[model samples]
Target: MPNNGCVAVNDSTFELHLKKPFQPLLGLLSMPYAYVVPHEAIEYFGNDFRKNPVGTGPFILKYWREGEGLVMRRNSNYFEFDHKGVRLPYLEAISISFIIDKQSEFLAFLLGNIDFISGVHSSSKDELITRAGALNPKYRESIKMITGPYLNTEYLGFLIDTSLQHVSNSPIGNPYVRKAIAYGFDRDRMMLYLRSNLGYPAHSGLIPKGMPGFTDSLKGYSYNPDLAKFMLAQAGYPNGKGLDPISLSTTEDYVDICEFLQHQLSEIGIPISIEVIPGAAYREMMSSSKLLFFRGSWVADYADAENYLALLYSGNFSPSGPNYTHFSNDKFDRLYRKSLLQSDDSLRYSYYLKMDSLALDYSPIIPMYYDKVVRFVGSDVEGMNPNPMNLLMLKRVKKIKNDTYSR
Candidate 1:
């Protein structure tokens, strides 16, 4: 086993010898944080290393004009090669523009100024995709839309730890209240109307759709206004008679979704006020456990369901780990440890399901929807593939003009 997570045996050689086999290490290694950094680059760049990065990748940073654009040229001596033994990164250069408005970005792509655009903003979503979640027929010849499951679960969290003063007094501290909030809103409608069906309704659990360990065994909370009313009455706030307004902290980007929730929950006796905080400050407050109720998303750092489940593990309490809700259970912790050490696939997944069901029973978080990676590509480009992580791999991408295709 590594003394401190890893060991360097010699020059050009590094190894991780685990005492007990950990299956998710492979997924963890694929993350950017796992990249090997050269000591020379760190020593030379110091605090400015972000501006002056040095790494062994497919492309070299050519130029970056702050708030404008950045350019990268292909690395001729890149280590990776194709099956036919040709060096990769066939594209000569990669250009990226810092266009703030997605509407303007779509215009530039239509004018053939950019190769591709990712994600559809509300400003341009209706123009490109119909309510049925299909691209408009008018763009069939010039544009292409690619979409798939993204490994992200957006949700609303609660500070369930009774040790916190606000949590003890707040109505959200009541489990029935949380469950009522979960059942009050229509997640399917949220996806259909707000997202244009770009995402899957997260009715299963926090695992999200298309991700491993996600199961329907629990048949999670669906939109049931009647049941929501029942739960509110059980919580001693029938028709919102005695319930106080619960503030939902969020950023400007999610105000629409929050507003949608605000209106829906209000109908079933739970009044919610939207507190639109600046992005960075909101994140800081969320991590510090200052916000009793807040909107957050867990984008998997790896491909495994363990990455998502870690957010609920008691040992990972913030501001240390991702356990923002401070939910703790003995059986859950036992299952988590077992799953982490278990090497068998079926057994590990079973443990995952059990843990997720337990968390749902507690209702510390309200699942919104599993995100989807939507892409808009120009006909002039090819060789791009969408993945759950939304990674941008430009190695084999090529551009076409007239009768010739150029990389």
Candidate 2:
């Protein structure tokens, strides 16, 4: 009676109406009232409730006034206890105020109005660091700064649809033409001119330098206009003479990168027009295969090399899957399948390397640059560790002395 759609209430009784089975229905029933309530109770409570929190965390929401501020009080009945067997959240209360402006937020941090400041805007990083350095000279050892590599990369992809007008219909569909385009763009110059040396030029294969299976042995598309032109000619578009005008579509955030790429391609005699589209519109066009060429990136969901290769190289596309390039290679697909089934790390990494090498050679998507997770924390915050994934684990965070509130 207990089919895939049936939910078993007990060993003998099958709750067929319920789609998912409850593992500990009776056990959960006997637990404390605090454990039974769902965390998203506020959403179901509707507009009537101002603060309807049902969290098991150390702090409980007390009040919230839209865009103004929010206040939380220590949860006395929280499951976690200190070494002394007392409830955690050593502070009295927490107050979070909204400051939309970065300048005002930095000022608040300087005045000790805020207990912590997580991420600083890219534009404000230099000024914030300078201010922090100046303050550190006077108040030695008061603040702690930590920086690390992020598990993210930014890349540009060429649209593969052959039906769209104004879209490059030449060898863009051919593996050699795509590889030529990858080689045509000077990644080093782009990083210097657009990113201001904040990003490292993508030289190694798709997995990034630090990640496993990544190899400097497998060189990426190097900047060689002559070679690119040669490949283009081989693909039947000699000096991009008879080719249609290439339109590069991307979000506003990456317009500058597209422009830089346009300039680079023009040097190689490829006439590229830049089209600045909104993020949503750009995504739609990419999904429908309407855009000629588009720019995008992916942050690793997990540590596996398959996370990068399978999404872009395998026949997976967006709106349904992760493959945006619409690239499909039987060899790459076979290698990816074998990598997933293999349990040994060394074997898996070897297969991943092979796949990455193929991708680099074929050029489904051009690897641009690896990203870094940059953030600024206030002096009063302690035990704040930054993860490569850029997620904040507030449970491990603690406030230092002169702190009036704790999260």
Candidate 3:
């Protein structure tokens, strides 16, 4: 481990010598990030394999028509077997289409042309599900809907880097002003109306639901314009009389939510200007720490609280890692480093909670809502796991013939 996988693995048989105690979870995480590539094929494809993946998994890359679709067939040499000692991967072939239009994809699912659809769009959510969050009766018999928590937290990030500060005396530079902005927006209304009840209002801290370290009791910022106004006043911007206008940067997908925040904060005398940029540009600016205030999200890299809390670590500042906000607290930094050395789950989680709570107290980010993993599967599909990470374990999934819905 100290040599970073070089001298640690000395044998061609792939035996590893560890300098420290082995953490199985750290190694288990490789499953999600791993892909085997043929050494000789690298000279031919170079980096083009992203669109044309070749793997020794349950399926083989049969064909790929860029911007159109791709097809994969079962791997005859796949090693895994089911409980009955039968070969795994029941599906004969898997076809994935690169249709960018959500509406077109939904139509394909409705017509039984596609076997599944993941994450329904707001425009078509009501058409596929009832107001009460259930599959519409018209399609209940033909389709199977699965819903579960997703390890993602969408939030508004406040840039703490002094170089990126909007003005020398900007009100947002004050923690009280950031706190006011956090409590000004109604996340419940945003989730219900703006998101069509697709996600849960993030009343808790950044570690999303279904994560081990998440504590439901830790109530985060709530919508209270009166309190927000008071905080703004305390920060020397009463009624926003002489305060500089705050610019909120976001991409096209989150423009509506940013506009909603703009309207809500305006009520508290904080005028917010929306800066909608392309997604690529937004990410570039965010990574370079060029944006003052921005909308961002954290999806779990692995099933660990460290994956989310690492964003607030002082050592992970922007341009190096994901600490885009440049948030740093002495207590948070100390506890985060200690948590990594902890071998006990409960002890590690306690440290994680402390760091998470500290970040919320600093108001470096306003946690908006936690996303949900929603999948619509044809009735014929079986053994589909609606994992919080939204992973597709096709090796365990099987498709059967059903008269009502067969694609």
Tens-place lDDT per residue, model 2, 1-407, is: 54555554654454435443432233233334413344256568866544675556777888899889998877777777667876676666778999889888877766767756666555555555543222224333444555555666677776554444533444567766776678788888887666655556788777764455667787777799999898888877888878766667788888888888888888877778888888888778787766656787878665556778866555576558777776777899988777766767788788888888877776767888876555555666765676656665454456667645322
Off by over 4 Å in 2: 1-63, 71-95, 118-126, 129-145, 161-168, 208-218, 236-244, 301-305, 313-315, 398-407
Model 1 C-alpha lDDT per residue in residues 361-402, reported as the tens digit of each score: 998988889999999888777888888889898888877665
Candidate models: Cα lDDT each: 0.88, 0.68, 0.83
Root-mean-square deviation (CA) per prediction: 3.5, 7.1, 3.6
lDDT of 2: 0.68
Stretches off by above 4 angstroms in model 3 are 1-28, 35-56, 63-69, 83-86, 130-133, 162-168, 238-242, 404-407
lDDT winner, 1 or 2: 1
Rate residue 380 of model 3 by lDDT.
Answer: 85
Best by lDDT: 1
Candidate 1 wrongly placed segments (more than 4 Å): 1-5, 10-12, 17-23, 37-56, 60-87, 100-103, 216-218, 238-241, 401-407
State the lDDT of candidate 3 residue by residue for 1-407, as single tens digits: 44545332432334345566533346244555743355457767888767566556899888888899889899888989899998978888999999898999999988889888888787688799876567889887789988889999999898876555353346667898899999899998888768767788999899999888899988888899999999988998888878878989998988889989999889889999999999888898999878878899998877888888889999999888999889878889988888877888898888888888888899888899999988998888888888778888788888887565543
